[model samples]
Target: MKAGWTSKPLEDACTFINGLWKGDKDPLKTVGVIRNTNFTKDGALDDTDIAFIEVEVKKFDKRKLFAGDIILEKSGGGPKQAVGRVVLFDKPEGDYSFSNFTAAIRVKSPDELDAKYLHKFLHWTYLSGVTEGMQSNSTGIRNLDGDKYKAIQVSYPSIGNQRRIVTLLDEAFADIATAKANAEKNLQNAGALFQSQLTTLFNRRAKRATHTTLGQATGGIFTGPFGSLLHKQDYIENGIPLVNPAHISQNGIEPDDRKTVSGETAKRLANYIMRTGDIVIGRRGEMGRCALVTDAEDGWLCGTGSFFIKPSSRCDAGYLVHLLRSDQCKQQLENIAGGAVMPNLSNTDLSNFALELPPVEDQKQIVAEIEEAKESVERLKSIYRQKLTALDDLKKSLLHQAFSGQLTQ
Candidate 1:
């Protein structure tokens, strides 16, 4: 809407070229084809994961990608991810073409339009939800409407103005990227520091402590109801919660709202009722995922994918949960876990696993220390996470300003 500026549909400004479909071809003689996987989330070309396809030299000559080509993802997006993701190709080494799931747009008049500008604009559109809104889903595959996408009008000033905008955006985004990377690294370091302290505490304690089987230290160890006793069909909309392995987290037990069973079904599986201070370990899937059952999780029916460890007076429940989460204990459990399809931990395995037990008072002290350290790390992580979020918002704000001609102003 500025003086001497013009708005035009993408179709008027560029020509769209479809990519080649995969066909029977020898890998040795075929050229590399850029699939949708080659497009990074940031709208840049990723050279990794390129596929090769055999095609006639004539066909290859016709479909070969050149520098400044903008490839758009036309199909094969899921519900959460939208189609119409675009990436700019800078003509890498070797002959390259794109897949049929994508289409390339080449500026009809390079003098009037810039490919990088178009690429940035399209990326903004995708991020802004405009492209996602234009998508149609069929058979679980989301496809972008080519005609609607082509009709998307973009307003721009002179090519010089466009280049200036691109330059400003590039510099600003680079700073933002660096800031984000530092923030992310700091966040990761915070978590790693906590993990290191945790490992050191457990390892040092294990060195000077007496070892005993979990069964000797715990009053009881029981697996959840077998699949035969509790069927998925027994789940009810509003009933006693069924705590599955997925609900167990390093922090604590997190019961799923969806995995509830009727009172009748719960009574039938009453033997697997969880109690406060019970240590619940994932019987399958991820190794060492365990949590201490709090008062809220007490009386919850344990699902088939979990094991409940009833801690005796000899062991602190919190300490036991931390021990199970430690790498040494996890490795021990994994060593005995067996299943053809999925790793499983049985009651016998749980009862036989060796645990280093210290004095109950010492265990509580260690748990308190670990919690304090985790809290410190978590606080730092939260701050850096907020900073990262702000940086992302700043990037989006800059993009909005750049595209709207506010940057040059």
Candidate 2:
């Protein structure tokens, strides 16, 4: 602790009030309500989607949020995120109350502890992963342990020093946030550049290109076995992997061993087995998700949500995979897509998917050029992504220093 600093339980420094429950009742006025969605990952409030709900007058009077109050997430977290995240409410007093999944923390004495100081400290605790231990889970929703959270010992110097620390953090964090935003933008631009190259290349070729359906270009289009033919009971922990739509990412296959079938089942579904040089394309969900089957996944079974295409002497497998994932192809697939809830691609539609096909040799050349462009884009993205990660680490380090009484005056 610093020389003039004092420490005490958070409950002693602030008053905690549970949020309001939007229950079934009559005779109430509608007001904007802050839900967990209003809280951003960076401990900031996102009020754009606030829900306006009717609340009892008495409940609103007791649960309404005020400026400088810290909103704490008491419930609703996922496997990767933890409950107990705190965001400061700097908005002016309004008819706003937090959801039942949250709680309000009001400073008991502004003369001793600054609200921003406490909010920053609590935010630091969350960023440093201190709150991960102060949580429990039930029925898929993570709940913060209120007893353990309020009992947290918050150490701070005098009010003057505390405000100084907050000011330092605010300035430093603002700069860091700006840098992070730039890095993220650069990263996105890198990917966009690659996509733009593909779109331009394909569009240019389409102008003076010979057109043909995928069925005429490829040897055959084989859909996976029906769900009735392959039961969930056939899945095994370690066996032949299934190339489901989820496994197809970034023009590559990422199979899950847990979502695999036994060798016997794979043999029974041998007709759906994808061989080397074959193209596996998703038939359900998001369109344009496809990957070329390599030697690594030569014998993997095509999942029910996907189908495989055999490249004939006419089409280059590499070129076909890239073409299928391009923006033009995605737009075409969307045109002939079925099912409104979950758009699906029928085998007939895929087989009859129209495309401007170049000569096999020219296709290979275009594939080489596109791959080279992709490599350059990936390298640029890597640098920007690393910068973003470093910025995040810097923020975490700053939080650690601030809480440890290491911030300069």
Give the backbone clash total of model 2.
0
How well is each residue in 64-122 modelled by candidate 1, as lDDT tens digits?
Answer: 88888899999988867889899998875678888889998999988898888888999
- State how far residue 316 of model 2 sits from its true place (Å): 1.0
- For model 2, residues 1-409, the per-residue Cα lDDT tens digits are 7677899999999999999987656668788888899999999999899999888877888988889999999999899998988899988867888989999999999899999999989998998888899888899999999999999999998888889999999999999999989899888888888989998776666655679999999998999888898888999987999998999999499999898998888888888989999999999898999999999999999999998999799999999999989877887897788677888999999999987887887788889999999999989998998898899899889988988889946
Deviation from native of the Cα of residue 143 in model 1, angstroms: 2.9
lDDT of 1 at 23: 52
Question: Candidate 1: where is the Cα deviation over 4 Å?
Answer: 25-29, 55-62, 203-208, 335-342
Each prediction's TM-score versus the true structure:
0.89, 0.95
True lDDT of residue 303, candidate 1? 81
Q: Residue 398 in candidate 1 has what lDDT?
A: 89
- Give the count of colliding residue pairs in each prediction: 0, 0
TM-score winner: 2
